[model samples]
Target: MANIKSAKKRILVNRTKAERNKAIKSGVKTAVKKVNAAIEANDKAAAASALVAATTTIDKAASKGVYHKNTASRKVSRLAQAVNKMA
Candidate 1:
C-alpha cells in the first residue's frame, strides 16, 4: 500500500529479502537440531559429522548476513563443545 513508486519497490524488495532470510534461518535451525539430536543419542561419530555440517551451514548463513559473525561463532562453539564433551 505504498503510494510512492520507490516506496513500493522498497516494500517488494524487503519482502523478498525477508523470505530469503527466513529460509536461511530455518535451515540453520534444522542443522542445529540435527546436531543436537545426534548428541542426545550419544552417537559420537554422528555428532562429530553433524557438527561439521552444522558449522558449515551456520558459517554460510553468517556470510550471507542472515546471522552476525560473533553469534554464529558462539553457536558453532557451543555445538562443538557439546560434541567434544561426549568423548
Candidate 2:
C-alpha cells in the first residue's frame, strides 16, 4: 500500500502500464503462433501472410518498448528463415 498521494498515483499508473504491456505481449505471442501454425500446416501462402502480420506486430512491439529492437529483429529473422525453408 502506498501512503503518500503521489505514490498512490504512481501505483495506479504502474498497474495500467503493466496491463497494457501484458496485452501487447499476448498479442505478439498470438501473432507468432499464427505464423508457426501456418508453417506447420505446410501452407506457403498462408505462412507468408502470417509472417507479414507477425513481423508487423513484432516491429510495433519493439517500437513500443515491449521488446528490444535486436530481440524483435532476431525473432523476425528466425520466423522468416523457417518460412523460407518451407520452399
Candidate 3:
C-alpha cells in the first residue's frame, strides 16, 4: 500500500498502463503465432497474408511503446524472411 496520495495515484496509473501493454503484447504474440502456424502448414499464400497482418500488428505495438522500433522491425524482418524463404 502506498501512503502518499500521489503514490496511490501512481500505482493505479501504472497498473492501467501495464494492462494496456499486456493486451498489445498478447495481440502481437497471436499475430506471430498465426504466421508461424501458416509457415508450419506449408501454406505459402496464407503465410504471406499472415506476415502482412503480423507486420502491421508489430509496428503498431512498437509505435505504442510496447516494443522498440528496431525490435519491431527485426521481428517483422524475421517473419518476412521466413515467408520468403518458403518461396
lDDT by residue (tens digit), candidate 3, 4-86: 99999999999999999999999999999999999999999999999999999999999999999999999999999999989
| TM-score of every prediction relative to native | 0.98, 0.97, 0.97
lDDT of 2 by residue, 1-87 (tens): 879999999999999999999999999999999999999999999999999999999999999999999999999999999999996
Give the clashing pairs for model 2: none
Encode model 1's per-residue lDDT on 1-87: one tens digit a residue: 789999999999999999999999999999999999999999999999999999999999999999999999999999999999995
Q: Model 2: residues >4 Å from true position, as ranges?
A: none
- Candidate 1 — what's its lDDT? 0.96
What is the RMSD, in Å, between candidate 2 and the native fold over all Cα? 0.6
- TM-score attained by model 3: 0.97
Screening candidate 3 with a backbone cut-off below 3 angstroms (N, C-alpha, C), the clashing residue pairs are none
lDDT of each: 0.96, 0.96, 0.96
Candidate 1 ranges with C-alpha deviation above 4 Å: none
Q: Model 1: what TM-score?
A: 0.98
Clashes of each: 0, 0, 0
Write down the worst ten-residue block by lDDT for model 2: 78-87
